[model samples]
Target: MKLKKFIISSLLAFASLTFTSNADAASVQTHRVQKGDTLWKIGMNYGVSVSQLKRENHRTSDLIYIGEILKIPQTISAYEKDLLARLVEAEAKGEAYAGKVAVATVVLNRVDSDLFPNSISEVIYQKDQFTPVKNGTIYNPASEASKKAVNEALVFRGQGSGSLYFYNPQKTSNSWLRSKQVTVVIGNHVFAK
Candidate 1:
């Protein structure tokens, strides 16, 4: 009876090990860097941030060479995801559905940009960056549309490629913003690089 119990335990342990190894293998995906690929672009494609990519790959710099392999992290923290949804709701309330997604895309674009912060919270809360945060509208509950838009933005990256700034042409008199080349105009806002 003791030998029988021991054999059963050994089989269970082996099955557990086999399942864990398979799960880990399924979770990880490798990407070979292309000539024109930047870490920002790669992260966007995988719904990850450049910093997360760097940390996962042990990369000290943004530099990546052609043919370099990178592991893409598939999960984002719940807090960060909620923050994005809130920002989208506050910023794009009353706007068209596409416009809401576009707004979220711009925030993601900024996170990927060298000129802006590397995270969602930092990009949204940067001084004078987002009006919703300044006016405390960001604390309001996110609309269903806004939440969906954020998820769509994550799945379909680069929808706002080369766009880092967006403003209502009617509300802003900032000469600097006016000078930026417009990438797209959705609803009432103008997106620019």
Candidate 2:
């Protein structure tokens, strides 16, 4: 009787382990490291941080073997991409392509800023933050250009000039925004910190 109980317990443990690893496998993908590849570049392609890659692979250094199979975490969710794409569409309509990309970068910059919320949703929906949200334009569907711009923004993440704000000089009468130093003038929008 004792032996039978031991066998059942061991089987249960094996089953639990198998299930857990399979669940993780669904979200984690393997990448065979290639020549001329840097951790930073790999992280950019996969929309993950270098630290996350290193931690996932159990490495203490940035060094990776050319043939090593690295476990890459899943990329940003579809919902986040869709939300960002929609925002860029509403905010950068009629603006240059560069302006659209820059607009998305500003939202990502806010997500990384200490002064703003740490999430895209929180930063976008914060009280009186964006005119589109208030005007109900944020709900509009995104365009292909805006969606592509969002993807490009993710690839070039952290390309922000510490810019946390953007506005059209001819449209906005906000003295506070005007007082801030301008970083880039793309199309009709003035990107600023």
Candidate 3:
């Protein structure tokens, strides 16, 4: 009788664990925002708060591009697929993976410093800082390489070269950079942490 009770308890515990795992797996999904979609609409559809959607998607501005993919916490399967897709895109278009990570790190650092916006979009879109925003590069529909680079940077927390600054050798000439020294150079960019 004792052996039978123990077996039943063990089986019950295992079944409960399996059910919980499945339930977690079934939550979360990725939705690519279309031209007509709004944050509120997406949030309502996903049964999450609009603020949550905006925060998770890292949208500083109210406006969103047509082709941008928004991750929704509706199903785990969709979330993973979108996450993988974004990672691939970042790597493919990222001309300087090292440089990209450095840039990301700088933004993150700034956010932590309390001298800059706390969100990724806010940091990247800050005035006169990032070239992509200033020159419309950020809105240029990021290349696959860039997407991959960004994903790698986000995932790995910007490792490699430890560069906190980079410059185009062809465009910049200053005593400061020369004094700073080089940490790593990738493609047309240089990085320093």
Q: Work out the TM-score per prediction.
A: 0.64, 0.75, 0.44
Report lDDT (CA) for all predictions: 0.84, 0.85, 0.55
What tens-digit string does per-residue lDDT give for candidate 3 at 84-190? 33322332244545555455445445554556676555655577655555554444444554444444444433234445456667767856765666877667666
Report the lDDT of model 2 for residue 15. 100
The runs of at least 3 residues in candidate 1 whose Cα sits more than 4 Å from the true structure, single-residue gaps closed, are 1-72
Candidate 3 ranges with C-alpha deviation above 4 Å: 1-116
RMSD of 1: 9.2
Q: Ranking by lDDT, best first?
A: 2, 1, 3
Total residue pair clashes for candidate 1: 0
The model with the greater lDDT, 1 or 2, is: 2
lDDT of 1 by residue, 113-178 (tens): 899998888988999899988899999889878877886677555434678889998999999998
Give the better candidate number (1 or 2) by TM-score.
Answer: 2
